[model samples]
Target: MSASLREEMELIEKHEEILGERAELLEQMESRREQLKLQRKQQVKEGEAARRRNATLLQDLQKIEDCLRGRQLPPPTILALETKYWASVEESIPAWEHFLQGKGPHPTDGPGQPSRRAKQQLKTHKETTKKTTNDQGLPPRPKPRTAR
Candidate 1:
C-alpha cells in the first residue's frame, strides 16, 4: 500500500476507538443520572410521610386541649377517688415521718430509701416490737417529739 493511504487508515482506526470510549462514558453518565432521580423521588416520599405524621400529631394534641378546656372540673367519680387517695396518704404521713427520722425500726433489705414492701415490713416490725416490749415488762420507749 502507498504511505499516505496507510496513514489515513491508521487515523480512521484511532477515530473509531475514541468514539467507542465516548459512547461508554455517556452510558455511565446516563445510569448515574437515573440513580440520582430515583433517590430524589424516595426522599420526597419520606418527607411527605413525615409531614403527614406531624399534622396528625398536632390534630390529636389540639383535640386533647379542646377537651380539657371544655371541662373546668373533673367528674365526681374522679374527684371522689382523688379525695380518698389524699386521705390515705395523709393517714400514712405520721408513720413515714417517724421512719424517716430514724426513730422507728429501719428496713433491712434495700439501700438508701425503703421500697413499698420494706415500708409494710417496717409497719409490721413496729407493731411486733411494741407488743414484745409490753409482754416482757419493759418500760415503754419515749415517743419522738413531732413538729406537728
Candidate 2:
C-alpha cells in the first residue's frame, strides 16, 4: 500500500478501538446503574417494614395505656378515702392528748391505753351528741368512725 493509504487505515483502526472502549464503558455504567436500583429497592422495602413495626409498637403502647387508665381510681374515690383517713386522725387526737397527760383519761378511770380511753370518750360524745340533737329537735350527726 502507498504511505498515505497506510496512514489512513491506521487512523481508522484507532478510531474503531476508541469506539469499542466507549461501548464497554457504557455497558459497565449500565450494570452499575442496575445494581444501584436493586439496592434502592431493598432499602425501600426495609423502610416499609420498619414503618409497620413502629405502628405495631405504637398500638401495643396505646393498649397498655388504656389498661392503665382502666385500672386507675377516679378522683372522687381517691378523695373519699383521703377524707376518711384524715377524719379518723382528727377523731383520735383528743384521746391521744389525754393519754399523753399524766392524769390519764380521768381521776376515777385507771391509766387505760389510749385506744380504750378514746373509745370511752367517743361513746360519751356520741350519747351527748344524740341528746343535744334530740333536745334541739334537729337531725343527729353522722356516726363517726373510731378507728382506721
Best by lDDT: 1
lDDT of 2 by residue, 77-136 (tens): 888999999999998777767767854554334554455667788999999998887779
Candidate lDDT values, in order: 0.88, 0.86
- Model 2 whole-model lDDT (C-alpha atoms): 0.86
- Candidate 1 per-residue lDDT over residues 1-148, each given as its tens digit: 6999999999999999999999999999999999999999999999999999999999999999999999789899999999999999998788778878977744333466776667888999999999987779767689999897
Error of 1 at 60 (Å): 0.8
The Cα error of candidate 2 at residue 66, in Å, is 1.2
Give the TM-score (vs. native) of candidate 2.
0.46
- Root mean square deviation (Cα) for candidate 2: 23.0
User: How many clashes does each candidate structure show, in the order listed?
Assistant: 0, 0
List the pairs of residues colliding in candidate 2: none
